[model samples]
Target: MKKLTYLFIALFSLSLLTTSCREEKTASEKVEEAIEDTGDAIEDAADDVEDEVEDITDDNK
Candidate 1:
């Protein structure tokens, strides 16, 4: 019974150590999300600029 208990404990500890590495969402994910947000913002700014240009052209005509 004691040998089986020791074996179980060792296996459990090994399992815990194996599962501890490779955690979720470090800096790369945040940077990627920030980049995606920046792209969307730039696209929105471009659309606004295009609308303004069209408005100015219509006014001129």
Candidate 2:
């Protein structure tokens, strides 16, 4: 009976540890996401600037 109890406890702990180990994004994944976000923001700002320039040129003409 004692051995069965110990075996059950060990299996429960193992299952818990394995579940906790799953797919939390690593540091590199986080850094890549940040870089992609920064690139997107830069692209958006550039597009806004281009639109503004076009509007100004249109108004001047």
Candidate 3:
């Protein structure tokens, strides 16, 4: 029974240690995220410009 108690405590401690650790992003991951953000911004800007052009053409017609 004592050994069983110690085994339970050890497993609980191991689980706590593993769960508390965080994984950090690598440099390539950071670069990829930045590139994705920039692409999304550019795409949004293009959509806005396209909408403005459509509005202008509709008003002229």
Candidate 4:
């Protein structure tokens, strides 16, 4: 029973330590991520436009 209590305490402490050690993004990191996301969105939009144009052209042909 004592060993089981110690084991539970150790696991709880380890969980606390892991949860508290999370990495936070800096302002510049956030800006960079936003820029990348915007770029990806733009690229996806462009691809979708291109696909629509091709479909329209194919239907016309």
Candidate 5:
């Protein structure tokens, strides 16, 4: 009876540990994705600024 109880406890712990380890996106991957997204946003903003500048310069000409 004690053996069965110990076996059940071990199985339960293993399942719990495995589930905890199964999350996607580790810290480094999340950081890298955020950096890439930020870079894209910055590039887009720069493009917008350049477009606005060109429009202003054209208007002034």
Candidate 6:
């Protein structure tokens, strides 16, 4: 009976550890997300600049 109890406890602890570890993102995943966000921001800024240039040219003409 004691051995069975120990086995159950060990399995429970292992499962909890694995579940907790999976909840957090890895370093590489975080860096990838940051890079993607930065790319999006740069694209948006470029679009805004293009619109401003077009407006300026239209006014000059």
Model 4 clash number: 0
lDDT per residue as tens, model 2, 1-61 = 9999999999999998888556789999999999999999999999999999999999999
Better of 3 and 5 by TM-score: 3
lDDT, candidate 4, at 33: 100
Please provide TM-scores, in order, for all candidate models, with all chains considered together. 0.59, 0.63, 0.65, 0.71, 0.62, 0.63
Q: Where in model 2 is the C-alpha error above 4 Å? A: 1-22
Q: Please give the TM-score that candidate 2 achieves against the real structure.
A: 0.63
lDDT for residue 14 in candidate 2, whole number 0-100: 92
- Candidate 1 local lDDT, 1-61, one digit each (tens): 9999999999999999888566678899989999999999999999999999999999999
Ordered from best to worst TM-score, the candidate numbers read 4, 3, 2, 6, 5, 1
Q: Choose the strongest candidate by TM-score.
A: 4
Instruction: Report the candidate with higher lDDT, 3 versus 5.
Output: 3
On the 0 to 100 scale, the lDDT of residue 7 in model 3 is: 100
lDDT of 5: 0.96
**Model 3: how far is 53 from its true place, Å?**
0.3
lDDT of 4 at 17: 82
Q: Write the per-residue lDDT of candidate 4 for residues 1-61, one digit (tens) a residue.
A: 9999999999999998888656999999999999999999999999999999999999999
Every model: Cα RMSD to truth: 6.0, 4.8, 3.8, 3.6, 5.7, 5.6
Candidate 4's TM-score reads 0.71
lDDT value for candidate 1?
0.95
lDDT at residue 15 of model 4 (Cα atoms): 92
Report the lDDT of model 2 for residue 56: 100
Q: Residue 8 of candidate 1: its Cα lDDT? A: 100
